[model samples]
Target chain A: MGTNPVPNKKLAIFTATGCRACENAILDIHYQVSSLARCADIAFWPYMLGSEVRDLEKQESIDVCFFAGAIRTSSDREAALKLREKSRIMVACGACAAFGGMPGLVNISQWSVVSGQSQRTMDNKQQTNEEEKPELPPLESRVLGLPQIVKVDYLVPGCPPTQNFLWAAIQSLVCNGQSPARLSFAASRLPEAIAQAITSGILPPKGSIFAGEKAVCASCSRVKEEKRFETYKRPYQAYEELGRCLLEQGLVCQGITTQEGCGGLCTAMGQPCRGCFGKAEAIFDPGAKMVSAISSTFDSNDAQEIAALVDDIVDLVGTFYRYTLPTQCALFSTPSKD
Target chain B: MSDFEPKIIAFLCTWCAYVAADTAGIARYKQKPNVRVIRVLCSGMVDPNYVLKAFASGADAVLVGGCHPGDCHYISGNIKAMRRAPLLRKLLEEMGVENGRFRLEWIAASDAPQYAEIINQMSEEVRSLGPFSPSTIK
Candidate 1:
């Protein structure tokens, strides 16, 4: 009797305009690396596999592509288009690909001046062989999240999504979550319901975020109390209250409006949540949501008092839209075909 | 720029600003026909996304008209809008939205003249700014 055989899925790891930490996160999956290796064949990971001849133009169609990083350079955009053409399932891994991570701050600052500064700061270049280093391509006008450049099937959000959430996404995509999701840091640490759903062996709907739907505040292990803000301070200024909600301490925690799944990693370590996870459910703009959500909790509703209260927020854009400006900003998003 | 009739997207709160618009229209108050109004339940309900979307889709100006502070029927809805407007304005400006392109003002239900005057003022401001060219932002 002949049995139906399933071919292994071809997975490509593509990266551009990022810190390359997402690639490391994938490798840091440590104990489960073999499980992932067994589930899919590495088709074209130029960064790690050292397999040159990137001419993906001739390779058989790739099954899934883990695309990490923003499209910042002409070469990056070109490669993204080529990868899109060759791959069937495109997963935007990490915040840069999904929402233009910290690097996206260049979108606000003068990108040209920034690039100019970079050239002046490359003092260590003489140590390396002059011809060995690749010429850095001129950056495009502004950084754009993956969706801005091409169609994206799914987004795994994070600065570089936590090792757990990312591994979950890979497992879900390749194994249909048939394998147990529970591990020391991967699934066992997640809220029970989320862990259950991820490990249920069902492929989530397309366009789904491979993270918790709840706001980061839900997972934040901080003592909750009524919040009535009178003053806002930078994290450095707050020296006393260490364990209470950062927002209550006026440290500008975005967890109240941010979608969770990193397990409030930064907030857990006495730092405010930077909202690397994009918008929470039903939030159209995290900035607008944060303003409304935070302002309502203010102790004083008086106009003068409130105006002063708002002045304490040092960088309004960096606080809420830190990760999402590229896709949400009208500047780049307008010309898209979507 | 003299003949330019800029497109303004106005998010008017239903209780006050929307009522003022209706009153101005019924009373035959002279107001520029440039503004395209989107009425919301409360000024606070107009998410910054709405304003950002308006600009994204080619709105020349965005006017968020709400009730005067303490005049909100829902108690403190305008207060919330008050809280968000300045920060949203700063954020949008940082993203390259010109000043005059984004505004939030209190218009009472009975202030039809003020509503008409405000529209004319906004139209003039936007006209002077020469239509929102997002290119300058980059």
Candidate 2:
């Protein structure tokens, strides 16, 4: 047993229909890419190395599998199931894998209806012959995050997870002898010395979030005054005022209900949070919790007035559950009986 | 359609709505028998998840009852519930849950007649709306 010694950790990267950003995140690790390459053998990465699924299946076991993308089709689901089974630790990478990402908004309507509508639009616009049209696989009834289909040991939360967080997670597992209970970018926002000091401590319980326990509002720099709003404004409808809370200014910033981990980057830049990080601890549904927060800020308790205020929000599902519709407990999709 | 009976899950505030239900029974007020009630300490305590869970678990409709705004035993608990009610309705509407399947009413402890009226009226409305479909729970 001692003869072989220094067993290399085998790593696999799986991406399904996700933006190329996930692949870029791996490359963006800069000089660490060499260290990562040295420490872990890249067993399979379909996007970069053009490895086949059969290659992954042939591996005895994968030490870590980094999966990115929502499971949108039958093939995606099949790949996710296979990768999950082959890996010892499966890390759901990026917003698409951890939550459902923007694609989850498709849950508002049936898949057939969505596909049919698109088909009709293409038919009218192009007037293409049947042979000219490219065939697309049938979409699953609902988009699903990785954890929805199989167990996920870790989540790297970002549109495409930041290279620092990805590197930190990999470094810890390779060198520290244990993965951090939860690995998030919250600490990465701090000065490098402080971030390192904070992360070096004992970790929280397993399954705990790697992000800040508080809502994004706690870390946000906006001034908070009375939260009364008579009307809501869409991001495009009005110019945001500087140094004021977006919600107080009548914009539906979801920071009050969203977990803090993105370093309030969007809010700092005067844009409302889209809640890509999912719910804070103890919150089952980020959308519902946001509804409670926004509704409570209304100036009136009268039903009609409240309804009027809510009407200002265009596309309620997209506004509330934009990034999290798939994993939310209150939102589920089942095949129709008919 | 006429034979359809709606199943309603009523979350009654312990201080007011629950007492009102007790008073309705004592006074022998005629009310719809389709309602099943769960009492909570305050209407403010009704997490929106409970209402969603009730609907998802196959209740045809959900009714949340709280004290009249100013009369809440916890000062502004009913007002808090009032604020949350419309938001919950908006969420339900977005999920394609039909109108009248979820309602919130303010009932004082003394208002047994009003309680009975709301239950009967909700039951009738939900009966016309038909059984809650599982697919719309999302």
Candidate 3:
């Protein structure tokens, strides 16, 4: 299924304004595709001298289009469509373009903002409770990233995807004629480097396990505590316990469950992995991760009780997922076409 | 202490809280006549801003009542409602409204007695919070 080698591949790196993350991603993409520099012509928008080639007539036509932000404006949609029309391959260049990244969160939370205006109208009391909400500002006024408004050919999810993932995507498309998901990180690189230093050989490539899924959990060991109990009267601040798996520590994993990617950075820094990787497989769901991490830490728990515990954790953390997604994560809110 | 009776707005879920309010009326559970109830399909459908709007529009207080968790006629509607309640309460509190002025209760379709109790408790709480002033409007 490989297409003919594009001898004169034109790669246009499309980016929106005010995103440092997109800038970082483009730099990484440039590094990976440097080998193709002779055959490929890459250009960036807004910052780069992209205005010269803004229309189709001026420069070399694009063969591969890399989008960097969640597409918000009609112009953005037009840009994506035009790029698709010109390019043979379209890649959601970074996390922002891929899942709608942080921009999708804006879309979800937008309801609240609209509701806020609704409150103002209600306060104004124009003699009707059924009054229509004020019209949302034009798409340009909203800070929509790419996927929010257009269809993406490939995704690389992360606040900014790791260099390896971004490189892998470009190499796959360039060298292998395939496009993979905008993966947060390449599983190939992990605790192995540390394991190599510790064990004098690479760690068994198998890091910690969560719910029988082979994803690594930095706080896996702590969750295996043999005894568990619940006390309801603690303060909200009491939820913070240093160095224990959040669930094992009897706190919510709001960060890990809601945020995507990174070896659960907050967990590594001695905080619970809040569910930041929204509704991921059990390997990532903080509740599911806890069941595995804690079950491994402790022994002999009532199965039914454990199930109930998981449900309660889901109930608590689910809000975090919902909060993060519609308001922040691009994967949930980015329209499929965008 | 103007002679004006405070206005209260209640957003009730159709399947549970709305039915419970209807039952309260049917069973002759006379509570505050100042409360106006608007029934929605589900409590989750009552957006937080709508409740806030009620307050901005001269409502001294706003009450949202839904089916108990897991008992939502539309499965998980009450859970969504529950999640929103605490946040809205916090929001109102930060905006300088007394925490008790905005309330969220879980009342089942058969809980007519509980409906009466909640309305009475909320009406009393609103009464103590005093008359609505446009100064709080934002």
Candidate 4:
């Protein structure tokens, strides 16, 4: 391990929605907390400290800012923009920030359908002239990842990145004077200082992913044989046999198309991959690519028969674009008319 | 409206449909000139992205041509393509694309007249449906 030339660099941790896990991830540093504290100053952390948005805005700059959550609303976008302005290196710190997470599945339905009920309820309450309430910020029609709104230097992708990977990122930044390679998912989107490294060929290509080059199936520990499925099975419908590939058994495991990360943890635990790590290299639409791959594996050739086989999938959009709907090409819809 | 000419993207499988297209040309079969044929190795090789991209980039309709069952050069490539067609159509429908904008047909190498007929029918159908405005999608 190397040492930082300038210690006590300022750090910020910004949370939006689904960020409770990242809050815990900070303490997950555990015994190494002291080591982290010794090198960098926690200049701002809204959840753990008294610092507010105004306080963060007051700072001239921060060495690193870890933003966790999907940009579902205007406020989230505001925070992301503010943090981007203040931080030298911005990291999208969780799945919600990296790939839109579970919230992105809302992309399947029309934007009005997803948010209309709440808007109607709010309108009804306002009409009653009850106690004064703070005006709510408008929501974006689509749930977007941090990178969709602002330049993100790194992405620590997981529902909450594993504690070990989190520590390695901090250690590499503080101890080695460089960001961890595993955390450099969107290095091309970095600001001047970091982008220069890629432009000058010191770092890897601009859009190089920090994780393993292969798809999750390459790292999966299950026994995979020739794949041919007569029917699709949802996880809740059956007991999956141990050590057998979930996809080979007709469960829609996304391992074959998902970028490798999280050590194939969900697959190891007998559940299919939800594709939170996003598409593998050379893949543009994670959902469509998986759909194509899965479709190719079906046993039948008759269009009616294949449609019947596919009809078994309860929610096509939810199943395929579980975490990546916002960025999926086929799901792109025009903005709401309202 | 009467002069509406649809812009069609026809993905022709090299072993069967491409040959049929050439035969149609040589035989002087009268077919709609609106269809732009892109020769691919096999219909199974047509990724959904190509179709989606074609629609996104302003194609009025996409026509995928493959070998009839048991006629595929790569053994079961057309079978794989058959399995994929329905799913791709379903996905397109979910995205709010109008029905009949995508068609999958099997054209044998010797069936030049049939190939010309299908293209003419598809061109007429897509023309009636009008231009595909994917404005709802970004």
Best by DockQ: 2
Instruction: In angstroms, give how far residue B9 of model 4 lies from its true place.
Output: 1.6
In order, what DockQ does each candidate have?
A: 0.48, 0.52, 0.02, 0.46
Q: Write the per-residue lDDT of candidate 3 for residues A1-338, one digit (tens) a residue.
A: 14634454566777653275755665655544456464455653545644533656565566567666665555666777677677666666554565444554444333457457645765666455446644432454344545455544555445565555455444434433212222213223333332232233211222121111223353243443444444221125444445455555555444433333455655555555544233344322233233333333222234344344434432332333332333232122223442
Estimated TM-score per prediction? Answer: 0.84, 0.84, 0.48, 0.86
In candidate 3, stretches whose alpha carbon ends up further than 4 angstroms from where it belongs are: A1-8, A29-56, A59-61, A70-85, A98-139, A178-243, A246-256, A259-261, A271-338, B1-103, B106-111, B116-138
Return the number of clashes found in candidate 2: 0
Interface RMSD of each: 2.4, 2.5, 14.1, 2.5
**Which 10 residues in a row give candidate 2 chain B its minimum summed lDDT?**
B129-138
Native-to-model Cα distance after best TM-score fit, residue A123 in candidate 2, in Å: 8.4
Compared with the true structure, model 1 gives a TM-score of: 0.84
Ranking by DockQ: 2, 1, 4, 3
Error of 4 at A173 (Å): 2.8
**Interface RMSD of candidate 2?**
2.5
Residue A310, model 2: lDDT of 71
Stretches of candidate 1 above 4 Å error?
A: A1-9, A53-61, A109-134, A175-203, A239-243, A330-338, B39-44, B133-138
Candidate with best TM-score:
4
Clash count list over all predictions: 0, 0, 43, 1
lDDT (Cα, tens digit) per residue for candidate 2, span A213-256: 67888889999998688888878765657899998888889888
Q: Is candidate 1 or candidate 3 better by TM-score?
A: 1
**Chain A TM-score of each candidate structure, as shown:** 0.83, 0.81, 0.54, 0.83
State the lDDT at A3 in candidate 2.
48
lDDT leader: 1
* Best of the two (3, 4) by DockQ: 4
lDDT of 4 by residue, A173-236 (tens): 4333333442343233333444345444354333333455578898899998887889888887
